[model samples]
Every structure is written in C-alpha cells, then in structure tokens.
Target: MPELLTTSGNIALTPATFQHRLLEWYDRHGRKTLPWQQDKAPYRVWVSEIMLQQTQVATVIDYYRRFMARFPDVHALAAASQDEVLHLWTGLGYYARGRNLHKAAQILVERYGGEFPVHSLEAMTALPGIGRSTAGAIIAISTGQRGVILDGNVKRVLARLHAVAGWPGKPAVERELWRLAERYTPDERLDDYSQAIMDLGATLCKRGTPSCLFCPFEDVCLAHAQGEERRFPESKPRKVLPERQTIMLLLRNEEGRLLLEQRPGAGIWGGLWCFPQFDDREALSRWIDAKAPGAILEPAWNSFAHTFSHFRLHIVPQPARCKRTGHVSEVDTLWYDSARPANIGLAAPVKQLLNASRPFAAQPSF
Candidate 1:
C-alpha cells in the first residue's frame, strides 16, 4: 500500500488518491467554456495567462476577447504599435503586463518565427513578463508537456491542504510549496491535471470563503483538520502606504480638444495618455504661461484619491480653456477630441475624468 499522509482524525491521503479525487471533481464541475479553453493554442493560452495575473476571471473575459480579436497571433501582435496594445489593455491595470506582452511578442516573431517554445520552460521564462509559473501554465495547458504551476490560486490551495506556515511570498515557504507541487504532478493527463489543480483552487479552495463541504479534499486537508483553513496561507505583512498629491490640467482648446500628454515609458501609467500633471499650482501656472500663454484657468474641481499598489494619489482636476499655442505642439502631446478620439491608452482615472469633463467642456465658460 502507498504510504498515506494522515490529515483529520480517521481520514488519510496519498498522492494517487489526491490526484484521482481532484481530477474526478474537475471532470464533473471544472470550467470548460472559458474563451481560452475553447482553443488551447499556445499563443491564446499565453495571452490569457498574462491577462489573468492579479485580475479576476470575470473582468479578464471581455479584455481577452477584444485583445484576441485585434491581435490574433504572435505575428500580428508583434507588428502592432505599443499604443494600440496598451489601448486595448486600458482599464486592466498593471500596464507593465501589456508592455511586456508586446515586448515578448516582438521577440517571438524575431527569434522563434512567431512560435512559442512550448517544450522549453527556460526559453519561455527568458521572455519578458513570463515567469516560471506562467511559463509552466502555457506549456501544461496549451500542450501536453509536463509542467508544474504555482500561481496564486494554486499556492492558496497547496498552502491550506498542507497547512503550510509563513507567508507564501517568503522564499522558504515558496520553496516548500514548489517541492510539494513537483512531487504531486502526475505523469499522464498533464493538461487535465494542471487545469484540475488550478480549478480546485479557484472554485472550492477560495481564499476568503472556501466551500469545504464541497471540496474533494475536505476530509484530507490539514487546514480543515485544524479548523483554520484561511490561516494556513499567512498574509503578507502590511505597512502604512505613503500618500502623493498632484494637480492635472484639463486644458480644452477652442475646438474642444483636450490636451493630453503621453507619460514616460517607465514610470506610473507608463505608455498611457494622461492630462498634464504638476506638483503645485505655481508650477501649473508657469506651464500655462509658457505653453498655453492665453489659457484661462478655472477653479479646481473636487479632489479625489487614486490608490496604487504602493501609494495613494490625491488628484485635483484643474480645468482650463485655451487657444492652440505653437509651443504646445509636441510629439509626446496631443489635442484629444472626444468626438474623434485617437486610439490610445488612458489610465482608469484619466478615462473617468474625460467622461466627466464632457459636460464641463459644453459649458459656455470654464
């Protein structure tokens, strides 16, 4: 008999039993109709995996569909401009993913002839934004290649099942989880097994409220035995997030075209278009005097906060009416006409402000 690992009183588990039960559960209740599941092509799988990072399934569906429609393949994505890729990726947050996806696509077209190296995990990981786990997912899900994935969902499931201690973000905790992941990975049904574990995590072993009764591993989960399922995957230590302040100039020309500047390719809102920002009113005043010399400044709108992963940005939307100044014409800047807006990426807050500014622009005066 295979050596069994005891969990709760009377119940025991082995690698074989765990795999069998999980796959059985998956065959009956796993997600099958997801857009990417319909076509297990490497390109499609890769894109979906990238989009799903730090994003929920429901939110990623529409974005995935639209992105696939526009850039159907690696070659197409490689040929497209970064602006269009980022435009489709707007509202998805994590602009770095979109940027890296574009960069990787270009590399694939140039080096691999637009084909994903499905069999080589190292080759896949060498690409920008494709981590070890993500690469493993692409290989395992898209191909029948043996691959082990330890994404967030998988990490949660593993942590709880084994009653893993310490924060998963820590090196020691992660290494142990990876060891368990590798040990349990079966030799056959690579695709189904990979998806099964992920599905088990996503559906039953959810982070906040796990359906322990419905879980196949309920009898054998060490965390359930201890009656502290949520406690196994320890949370990351938290610190007070710093705050930042900025004033965005919503300068509208006589033609009602709003002034937007392209943010640098490396910092916040990278590769996206946003209203001109200033540290203070004095700096804003000087820019207006130099660039839009005769622009009329209006009272600042109600301030609000936009929180990022590390900081909270307090924004003051300062509206203005201006005439086209020659100095304002720059390659990095554009006069955005709402009626015929250019296809470009806008940060979520910027998009919301633009929608809100329509009525403001219609007013006779600022």
Candidate 2:
C-alpha cells in the first residue's frame, strides 16, 4: 500500500482517506459540464486534449466548437486537406498541434480503421505529435485504462502536493513526479480520478495564487500546512529572450491586389501567407529598388511587436505600390484581393492588419 509522503511529513493515503476527501470536494466543486466532458468518445477526448495544450479552455471553446462542426469525426478530419485544417487552426498558437492532429487523424483512419487503438500506447506515440502524456490521457479517459499522465497542470499539482523541489523540466525531477503519480492513481474509477486530479490542479491548485480555502487536499497538503503553498514547486532561473527586428513590405499592385508569399513549411509562422519580409531595412530597400525600380513608397503604416516564448519580434510595416510584369512563380509570390484573405492562408497577425485596414480601403477618398 503506497502512501502519500510530503517533505514535511509522511501521511498514509488509504483508499478511504483519499477518496472521501478528494471526491467529496470534486462532487461539489469540480468542473462538470465542459464541452469535451459531454462525450467520452476517444476522438472527442483526443481532440480536446490536443487543443488544451498550452491553451486556455476559454480560448479553445469557440475553436473547438468550430473544429468539431467542421471535421465532426476521425474520418472527416483525416479526409480534410492540411491547408484547410491549418486554416481552421489559424489563430491557435503552436501550429504543430493542428498539424499533428491532422496527421494523427490520417493514421487512425488508415492504421486503425478510423477508431483509436485500445491500450496501444506505442501505436499512439508513433503518431506525429501524440506524446506519452497525450496518449496516456486518451487511453485513461476514453477507455478507463490505467496509464501515467504528466501534463503541466498535473505536474504543478503533484509537485506541490509532494513538495517535489528542483525544476520539473529536469529528468530526475520528472521521474520522481511520475513515480508519485503512478503511486497515487487509483485502480478503479481511473478515468474519473484522472479528470478529478486535472480539475483540482486547473481550478484550485493554479500556478500563481492557488485557491487553498476551497481545495479539498488543503488538510493534508504539506505546502499548505507549512504556509508555503506557492513555494513548493521551486522556480527555475530565467533567461532573457533575444530581440529580433524585421521589415515587412506591404505592396499592392494596380488592381487593388496585395502581393504576398507563402512561408516555407518550417520555422516561425510556417505555411502562412505574409508580405515579403527582410531582416533589415537596408536589405528591404535594396530588394525593392532592384526588383521594382521607381516604385512609390508610402509612409510606414504600423509598428508592432509579437513575442513568442523564446524570442521577441519587432516588425515595421512599410506600404509600397509596385508594377511588375515578370514571372512570380519563381519567388512564391501571389496577388489576391485583400478583402478575401481567407482564400489564401494568411497568418493571424497579417490577417489582423488586413482586416483593420479593410474599412479604409473600402471607402474611396481621393
């Protein structure tokens, strides 16, 4: 009988003690009616799990609804084009999730006859982006199978509950956390227990300022008892994000068509349409002068900054008018009506800029 031990003291976690305490709180206060919880179908659980990665539930609600309405099932999703799938997942950061979902759907249809495999962690992990945690979640939640899950929310919860110190990113810390998770997971009610733990972490044991007053485990929580609830999961040293500067060319042709190019299918904002960009203003000016000589250059429209987890991008938008009669296929360039940008795959930031300028572009003022 494995027991729950904390840095402060060792506490026996019998079935009755754990269930009576946690389940009582869950029954009264846990989140119950989330859209994904409505169906325990493997597909539904898989989609929601993937969408919930590094994204908030509030942000994923509309996207999830729209995505389900569009794809509806594994077959539908597998049959859809990558471009369409990526377009649907446009605003969702971490584009890799969308791409992986598409790939996984295809794998399910072709390899497993459009049904998720049962208790096949290896098969699930073989898919593009279905990691160990995600595969475990699908198996545990949908099939009621016992498996280890180590998502960020779960990590935070377990780290604090056990007072596991050191950066959770390190291999040693992660192994200890996994051991604790494996030990505490109940045999029966596996799915419900998984959801309960995740809910506890998401709702009560949040990263910053946890709601200790309402937490069921507050009585036994070592961190809470020690009056250092926030200090359980020791913080890691931070590194400064590097800054990058770039110039974006907002070029238009004679017939109100914008010139854009599709980015390569790797790196930042891959496979999305954007204005021709250069790392430096001098390089941009040289390219424009050489390619489209005597083109009229207007004042800069907007200067904005977009930050990623690791880097910050400072972008300057320079509007220009050019007339050229050479082949554009060599440069991956295309001209499209700015009003209908969805026809082409424009990145979210580019789409925002285009939509903001639509009203002005519509009105004819000399």
Candidate 3:
C-alpha cells in the first residue's frame, strides 16, 4: 500500500504504516537511554513495567536502579526475604507491587527455575501482579513477539490516535482498544514498535498540555484533528475519597533507636514497617502503659493528613522517650536504628515523619 503523508511530512497512521512511522520517529527521537532499555531481558522488562504502573518514568528511574542493584535477577530476588524486598521498595508507593513482585519471583524460582517464563504471555500473566498489558510488554520488548500492550501511556496515545470514545476502563471501550492494539502491532520490529508507541505516549501525548505539533502522528491523530485530545481518553467516574484519623507513635529508646512494627500483609502499608498506630489518645496511652512501663511521653505534635488512593489519614504523632530497658520484644516489632538504614523497609509517611522529628530524638522538649 502507498504511504499517505501530509504537507508537513508526517505520515497518516494506518494499520499498515503506523509501525513504520512510529518506529522511524522512535529511531530518531525516542528515549532509549532508560536503564531497562540497555538490556532487553524479560526480567528487566517485567520489573520496569511493574514499576512504571501509575508512576512517572522520572520517578521510577532511581527506584528501578536501586531495586535492580539489590536484586540483580530472579534468583537473587527469590532467595531474599520479603522484609528485604519491601525495604528496597520502601519509598516506592503502591507497595503491593513490591510484595507481588516478591511473590511472583518465588513462584518463578520454584516453577521455572529462577527465570521469567518468557515462552508465553499467558504464563507470565498467571503470576502475581502481571496483567495482560504487562505480560505483553515483557514478551514483546524482550523477545520481539507481536504482543500488544495498553498501559496508561499507550492507552492515551491510542485513544487520541484513534479518537476512541468513552472511558478506557469501561468494558466495551477497553475491548475496542485491545482490538485496535492487536491490529496495529506489527509483525516485524515488534520490540521497537512497542517501545516507540509507549515513548510517544509518555513524551508527546501527555495527560496535560500534549505537544501535538511534535507528534509523529500529528496529521493522523483523530483527537488532535478535532482539537479534543484530552476528550478521547475519558476520565474515570469520580467518587469521594473517605477520610480517617489515627495516632502514630514515634517512640525512641535511650540507644536512639525508633520503635517500628511490621504491618500485617493485607491492608494499607502491608508488610511494611511503621510506628504503632492508634485510633485515639486513650488507646495509645493504654498500650504505652502496658508496653513501656517507665516511658516518658513528649508533647504531642499536631495532627497532619496523608492522603491515600481511597482515604485521607489524619495522623497524630506522639513521640516518647523510653527509659525502660525491660520491655518485651514482639516478634515483628523492633527498635530500628535509622543509622543502619538498610535493615528494614519503612512506609513513606513513617520515613518522612521520622526525618522531620530528628531534632527531638529521644530527649523530651520543654
């Protein structure tokens, strides 16, 4: 088929020509310097895809480097404990990704002998935290399979390119997008094409203030033509996020270790270390009396709000200087010496709170 082009030299994206144009543009101007791009191993692709979910590339870059440095491969990740895994993933929010990555690594080690099951997309998706799009990305980027992906960036890129209507989360709209993705994915240069579309989405077709003039598909993008790029990828239905309150303690011993407890592996901040939390001051005092017999309580700090995806947490931090050395040691609780830093994984808010409270230390303020 003859290629269609605009006077500005950009090609009109059709199923046959979209890959060529995108890849041509990607060759000249795509972000190939990403840490994961240097090595197209399935493990690296899978890890990068998971970290990129709901997170910007710039933010994930440092986290990805640190995580890869710690857990170099599946064998290294599988042999490590969950605490160790979560610790490396501390500041990276959506912690379930960390847990699920650990869980999936164990499964891979046990079932596939410490390697990603790159032979099939279905096998990859069968593991924890590996969705269809992620699985496709892992396979397509690593093995040059004609696998299709529809992550947030690709979703926006495709939605605008095709002018897809309705929310991408909707069943019907998603099915259509999936069909389009499958149709457009090229048989040749599959890896470059996959990365090209993703790079295009992340760079040009952004959520706010898209650089339409620079996009390769500028002449062909339906949404761009209609001046409704944002409208194509419809927003999710909005609902009110709930708010809750709690008292978070930052107890310190004479040795200058902060009291940190491992959270249960199910709810918010699951399997992560945080200070003891209470619904009210009364409950907090009762626990303190029972746990630290001669601990002296410092003046409480004002309640501050931390927003989660579903709720807002109003945290009242109550720091204490404990003189007692006879406190019972709980299995999952510890006096964490922040000086060591790498022994445990802390929740983001806890880390922030502790960092902000350094001046007080274990000594009480008047």
* Best-matching candidate per lDDT: 1
How much is the lDDT of residue 215 in candidate 3?
81
How far out, in Å, is residue 313 in model 3?
1.1
Better of 2 and 3 by lDDT: 3
Cα RMSD for predicted model 1: 2.8
lDDT of 3 by residue, 1-366 (tens): 333343222334567788788888999999898999999888888899999999989999998999899989988988999989888888888889999999999999899988788777789889999999998898889999778898888889888887889998899999999988998898888889899999888887888889998887877887887788879799998889898999998898888888888899988999999999999889988998899877888888877788888889988888888986559378888877766665577888898877776655652421
Task: Report, for every candidate in turn, its global Cα lDDT versus the true structure.
Answer: 0.89, 0.79, 0.85
Candidate 2 local lDDT, residue 151: 85
> Whose TM-score is higher: candidate 1's or candidate 2's?
1
Indicate whether candidate 1 or candidate 3 has the larger lDDT. 1
Error of 2 at 341 (Å): 3.0
Query: Candidate 1 regions off by >4 Å?
Result: 1-12, 360-366
TM-score of candidate 3 against the unseen true structure: 0.92
Off by over 4 Å in 2: 1-7, 289-294, 324-332, 343-345, 361-366
What lDDT does model 3 reach?
A: 0.85
Candidate 2 backbone collisions, by pair: none
Q: Compose the digit string of candidate 1's lDDT tens values, residues 236-322.
A: 999999999999999998888899999999888999999999999999989988888999998888888999989999999999998
> Which candidate leads in TM-score?
1
TM-score of each: 0.95, 0.91, 0.92
